[model samples]
Target: MITIVPVETKKQRAAFIDFPHDLYANDPNYVPELFLGQEDLLNPNKHPFYKHSSAQPFLAYKDGELVGRVAAIYNTNHNAFNKVNEGQFGFFDCINDQEVADKLLQTAEEWVKAKGANNIVGPINLTTNDTCGLLVEGFERPPMAMMPYNFPYYLDLISHAGFAKKVDLRAYLVNKAGANQRSVLLLDKLEARLERSGIKLRQINLKDFKSEAEKIKKVYNKAWDKNLGFVPMTDEEFYYVAKDLKMIVDPKYCIVAEKDNEVIGFALGIPNINEILINIKRGRLLPTGIFKLLFGKKNIRSIRVLMLGVLDNYRKLGIEACLYGRIIKNAMPSGILEAECSWMLDHNYLMNHAIEQINADLYKRYRLYEKAI
Candidate 1:
């Protein structure tokens, strides 16, 4: 018999967090999320997301053995912003059993239904602002930092369970050795042209990070406001994330486009720390694991250009090329072998074309699924 259990106690929560570690043990490309980080994300008191939204995690068991897990999420901010009644399912994992997958999704669906959601959409862990989407393509390599991964069977499982593709997200790969240097070569001229219009490019200032982040936050929200399912981050939420990224951020790859000292655009590229975390057993940062993370920084050879945005009015100003070019130029000297510009909406042609201009290959694809109740 299959039993669906709400993760109420600490032990149940731990099991919910650790289930994927066991499920993916035999998969070489599986990368375990950090235990503490996962814990905080699910914790209402620790994560700012819970301040305005609520999510309940459920675990599925077959004959008393854990087989699947999912989280039912109702984001008040999302509904209020998008003007829709939609719930999300995220942090999903399961074995190859169809029955287990069905039960896990059903539990999430029912929970959100009780919260008055008429439509369900996801694999959206918390929100679009966080790690969201299911890997539908590119199963050959392990995922980069803050990206999601899943087994091939998940596609069939979700489809059989009545979910259909809502949208596809794209990830592009640019290797230093093969990347076209047109962006780098034309970077100076582009910036010079932008300068004539009072816009200039520069790296982020680590010393004034607090003020800088606040300014960039405005640009981030404005630049991405029109994106599908996009919700502006609250002050606490932005700082909560910014504080964490601060530890791994390199000033060289974090550049901004400014006009009279006002940040109109910015790009942030973080080290692919998954290189080190993949080796840390069960994502535990303890004993030997912490040492691996502390000492592994110098060995990392790649980055994820996770955020690159320009204000709507600033579009078509060659700001995008300048930002990307600056990152590529800076990365060359740092021995960064490759970079992944990721999670772009499949339909974003303008931005996609900009990345393609630098010879980035579309290597991976992820999807979001939705079903109307």
Candidate 2:
């Protein structure tokens, strides 16, 4: 017999976070998420998202053995911003058994419906601004920081459970050794043209992180306003994210374009820490994971350009290309060879073009799903 139980007690919550570790025990590509980080994310008082929305996590079991998990979320801010009665399902993981997937997803759908949601969309992990989607393509390697990964069988399980693709997100991989030299040569010229317009790009100042984040937040809110399912992040939420990133943020990889002291564009790349996390053993840092995370950080060889955006008025001024070029050049000294720029909406032509200019290949695709409640 199978049963679905709401994650209520601390022990149950810990199981919710640890289930993937056991589920993917034999999968080499699977990287366990930090227990501490996952705890904060699931904690209503810890994550700022709780200020405006709520989530309920559930675990599936067959004769007392864990089989699946899911989070039913009612993002009030998402509905308010998009003007739609949509709830989201996230943190989803399940076995190959269709019954397990069905029960877990059904639990989530019913929870969202009880909250007055008319439609359900997921696997948002929480929200579109955060990590969402299932890896429908590119299963060759482990995922980057803040990215999602799962077995390919997950695709069939989700679809068979009645979810349909809402949109496809793309990720591009650029190798420093194989970058198109032609585009690299054009970067200097691109900089000169932008310089003539009084636009200059520079690395983010770690010394003045608070002020810098404030400026970038403004540009970020405006730059990605029209993106599919994008909702302006609350100041609290942005700060929450910024504070966490400040730890791994490299000055060289975190950059901004300024004109008259206003940030018009920005790019952020984080060390591919999944390499170290993979060895952290179920994302626990207590017994030894902490040392692995701290000491193994320098050994990281790849970076993920998780965010790059320019204000609408700043488009076509070569700012985007300059940002990409700067990140590539800066990465050379760090022994970084390949980087992934990801989660671009399939319809975002200009941003996609900018990535291609750097010789980044469209290597991975992730999809979000939706269904009427």
Candidate 3:
């Protein structure tokens, strides 16, 4: 018999977090999330998302053995901002057993229905602002920073459970040789051209990170307003995220553009710690896991260009390419050989064009799913 239980206590939550560690124990590409980070994310008091959203993690058991897990979420901010009554299911992990997957989906669907939601969407761990989506392509290698990874059977399980594609998201790869010298050669000229329009690119100011992040938050919320399922992050939510990212955010890889001292665009690349986390043993930090995260961070050879957005008014001003050029230029000597620019909307032509100009390949694809509740 299979049982689906709401993770209500600390022990249940720990089991929920550790289920994947055992499920993917033999998969070389599996990367472990930091146990401390996972704990904080699930803790309402620790994660700001709980202030405006609600979530419950569920674990599936078969004959008393753990088989799968998922989280059912209702984000008030997402609904109010998008003007849609969509419930989301995220942090999903399951075995090939269709029965277990079915129970998990039903549990999530029932929870959303009780909340008055008419439709269900996701595999979104929390929100689109966080790591969401199922890896429908590129599974041989590990994922870049903040990207989700899962088995190919997951697509079948999700779709088989009646969830259909809402949208497809793309991730592009750029590396040492992929940076293309041709673009580097014209960066100075591109900067000069952008300068004529009062736009200039520079690295983020570490000394003013707090204030600078506030400005970037404004730009981020506005720039991505039209994106599918996007919700404006509250100040507390952004601060909660910023605090965690500040640990791995290198100044060189985190750059911003400006015009007349106002933020216009920015690019953020985080060190690819998935390489280190793959070895973190169930993503635990105690018993020497913390040492690996601290020591292995510097040796990471790749990065994930997680964010690069230009305000609506700043489009076509070549500011996007300038930001890319600066990041690519800085990666040359830093031993960071490769990077990924991800989760771009399928129809985002202008950004796709800029990514192509830098020779980034669409190496991975993730999908968001939806179903009528």
User: lDDT value for candidate 3?
Assistant: 0.91
Q: Find the candidate with the highest TM-score and give its number.
A: 1
Q: Whose TM-score is higher: candidate 1's or candidate 2's?
A: 1
Alpha-carbon RMSD of each model = 0.7, 0.9, 0.9
Q: List the residue pairs that clash in candidate 1.
A: none
| Model 3 / residue 164 / CA error / Å | 0.7
Residue 30 of model 2, lDDT score: 93
Q: Is candidate 1 or candidate 3 better by TM-score?
A: 1
Scored by Cα lDDT, where does model 2 land? 0.92
Instruction: List the lowest-lDDT window of 10 residues for candidate 2.
Output: 179-188
For residue 300, what is the lDDT in candidate 1? 97
Q: What are the lDDT scores of the predictions, listed in order?
A: 0.94, 0.92, 0.91
Residue 330 accuracy (lDDT) in model 1: 95
Give TM per candidate. Answer: 0.99, 0.98, 0.98
Clashes of each: 0, 0, 0
